[model samples]
Target: MKDVLMNERHMLSRRKMLGGAGAISAAVAAASVSKVAMAALPEPVIQTKPDTMPPLVPNTGRPYNPVVTLNGWTLPWRMNNGVKEFHLVAEPVVREMSPGFKAHLWGYNGQSPGPTIEVVEGDRVRLFVTNKLGELTSIHWHGQRLPNGMDGVTGLNQPGIPPGKTYVYEFVARRPGTFMYHPHADEMVQMAMGMMGFWITHPKGKHPLIDEVDRDFCFLLNAYDIDPGAATPKIMTMLDFNLWSWNSRIFPGIDPLVVRHMDKVRIRVGNLTMTNHPIHLHGHEFLITGTDGGPTPKSTRQYEVTADIAVGQMRQMDFLADEEGDWAFHCHKSHHTMNAMGHDVPTMIGVDHRGVAKQITKLIPDYMVMGERGMKDMTEMEMPLPDNTAAMMAGTGPFGAVGMGGMFSVVKVRKDQKRGDYSDPGWYQHPPGTVAYEFTGALPDPARFKADVSPGPGSMPSMAKPAQDVEVKVRKPAGGHSGH
Candidate 1:
């Protein structure tokens, strides 16, 4: 199998080169034969803007859309005849995980997790990938069923898209499903550096169940192990990853999923991390309707409050936005929902370090004991961190500073939200009588009873009761009792 694939790749590369040469030869012959005609030919039209239209829901004409990613957008494609043409430039990018934090990562078209690629099922797509990095790279269309030659596997389906060179992949989008794209060459390092994107193919025509949805969203799950003060990810560290994100963004910095009340919504989540994520939706239940393979059969769809997206897998969740409020939608793994954490800290819950800290402060004036009681105070302490350190575990909520960070975000559904508006509607307001309060004017009394009283050595006498108490009788045993 390996030998066969290699031969095919070499043959394809030769064909591509010969095809280019043949086109040039033909153009030269034409120009030589008719110089005047060549001069009179009109200039080719150049498009400065993309002709991409808003994506549609699966079976319905209703537009289910995602809010703009905090620092990302959908890739724009141009229509050439009936084919869609997209250009991707793979290079290094400086992405801000949130305010005060940034990382040096590699991505396509200027953003990590790249841009969402949306197309109708059965459309012919011509994707041109230009590699600007110093090393060779290849983009594998994850979960897309296409010709083997266009599979984008380096040295397997085709040659590596060499640095400073552009490679073209043409394919007919076969199935309507959630998919992803990333480098298959040096996959571990490239993926760890944030080279990935979402690929979404809408179903052709209308399907009874998937056609119409009120809101649609797509995000890629990724993890990193960049230290708090590091600007670049430590690609070698896989198990000890500290930065968890959805589309390279942590919560509070990530845009909330906004929808109108009662709107049918679909959120497409793709996991590129090594670990599985049990994504839980607070205040609502969703059905797993589709996978990367294709749409799930109606009979097989199962409703769930949390859906597990495994490594290199994708899931499409559908739900009705019947509830109104800012509901949390996040990974259920406790630590997965938090930003950078110190994994080597010891238990300090009951350790009293005041005396030790006092002595150390005399030698080092700025020194302070940390984690002695708990870590909640660390959120407020502006300790000296290394240069380029990102405040990994930090966020501010309405009530106060939020200590939790990372793969967490809210899904906001508002009843009075304006149509086509994706803005947040603030926090939820309770009805006049729904809020909890302290009960002050309440009284209860226990039943009173009388019993014989006996005291042992070293025992104290029973305390006197109020006027409503029953009388007690004292008793002495026939033989003197010794108390030990």
Candidate 2:
């Protein structure tokens, strides 16, 4: 079933390159293979240096992490007596991916997506928002719980955060965990346009409840709507708002979600689009310890191989990295993998027509024929070869191995952990380990915000039920580390 389409051509090329009068000896071949095995996978992509930019301004004195002081009443505020307002604005902006195709998106901070807001559990949160766009707006504290009056609803709980005027949302932070805040006013228009961010809540304790852990990381999932060509922007209709992304855009092959070897990574994934994404990673399953609110009941904690993160939902999961390799993490939706406005073209090497086109052709050749003639001619009996970059990264063939069905990503688990024993909790330790690494990437540098950032309140006022008495215990793999 694992048919190699052009294996002969590749083999011939390999033989020609490795053979002849200057052929490599057996020892050299063995050495090369060993070296290849030992070498680390390529690093995930980094920030691109903008070619055109404003002149640099001299640095002003500032701290590594800036803080803004807020004067709160020393007296405790009652949840029953007061209501607060929070306003969120949704607007479309063009980001320069390239002149040919700027990223057309809707954002809350006047850009695609919005800013992250972290608050302490039990803190009173009042969100005041003013919408400047033509369409109406409202903010739904997704996965958050407070009084029902503060729920951002266009018609149900309160009026929409109307255009030109401010809307206030006052609520008390009860439970704590990672969550999201986005527009619920006109989901089709608002989510498509951007208007979302992380609403994190920190537990009152200084350290994690567990004794051995080190750090935490948070990730936001999103899909973008971008049209490759045609200067005019593409409007997101209810049916065809077709761009998908995690964080913000399609991650280039080289630039992907990453984690260090032998590290503990906590990922908080939120889905705001109309679609659901069954997020999957190659190599291992992750522990689902937390949900929209706080930690799940110990008895009900899940280790998910493929978690379904649906629209208007959020999930918190963690995993340890015991193997070292580049991991490709992405949405399992067949349509979400679409890049560059759903053009169905491969990222071929060296074809620089547009930034997207050139990247596609150069980096991922398998997709070169996606929209080509007869490409869509497959009958129900015909299953085409998998051409996704993620599949290649996972080294799996279509219909022949794992990483198929659009549910795959690279998760580099370091090889430093003891093979026969996975008992150590070293992976979650702080600094360069799990906790610091995951949160560091998302938390803005001091330069971005002049305010304190920490976790905040989020949970539905309507909880399934108060979790009854549950036992807590350390978890172990069923077979007790088979060293597989």
Among the numbered candidates, top lDDT falls to 1
Clashes of each: 8, 52
Q: Could you give candidate 2's per-residue lDDT for residues 1-484 as a string of tens digits? A: 0122112211211112123323323322332124222112111111122121111111221111111101000001112123211223345554432222345566653344454555556666655454556778878887788778777777887776545454556677777776777777877666666667667666645434321222244445655544434322344544444445554544332122344566666666777665677887766678777777567766776677778987767777677766454455766666555444333334333333455655777777543332323222212223333222112112222223332212233443445544322122222222354322234457655666436776468766764655786566544445332232
Task: Report the C-alpha lDDT of model 1 over 1-484, residue by residue, as the tens digit.
Answer: 1121122211211112113544434433433223122222111111111111133222222233432333355655555556666667788877878666788999976678786777777888877676768898999999999999888889999888766566677899987888889999999999999999888887777866574687777788899988877789998976768889888888666777778999988888999998899999999999998888888889998789999999999998999999887788899988787777666655576679988888998999989677776877777887776666555457776666677678988888988887666666787776687656778976778765556656458767769857797677544443222221
**Candidate 1 off by > 4 Å:** 1-71, 209-211, 382-384, 433-484
Per-model TM values vs. the true structure: 0.77, 0.53
lDDT scores of the candidates, listed in order: 0.72, 0.46
Cα RMSD for predicted model 1: 14.9
Q: Candidate 2 regions off by >4 Å?
A: 1-89, 95-101, 206-215, 230-236, 239-241, 253-255, 341-484
Q: Which RMSD values do the candidates have, in order? A: 14.9, 26.8
Q: Which residue pairs in candidate 1 collide? A: 58-211, 59-210, 59-211, 60-211, 60-212, 64-216, 65-216, 229-389
Pairing residues by index, what is the TM-score of model 1? 0.77
Write down the TM-score for model 2. 0.53
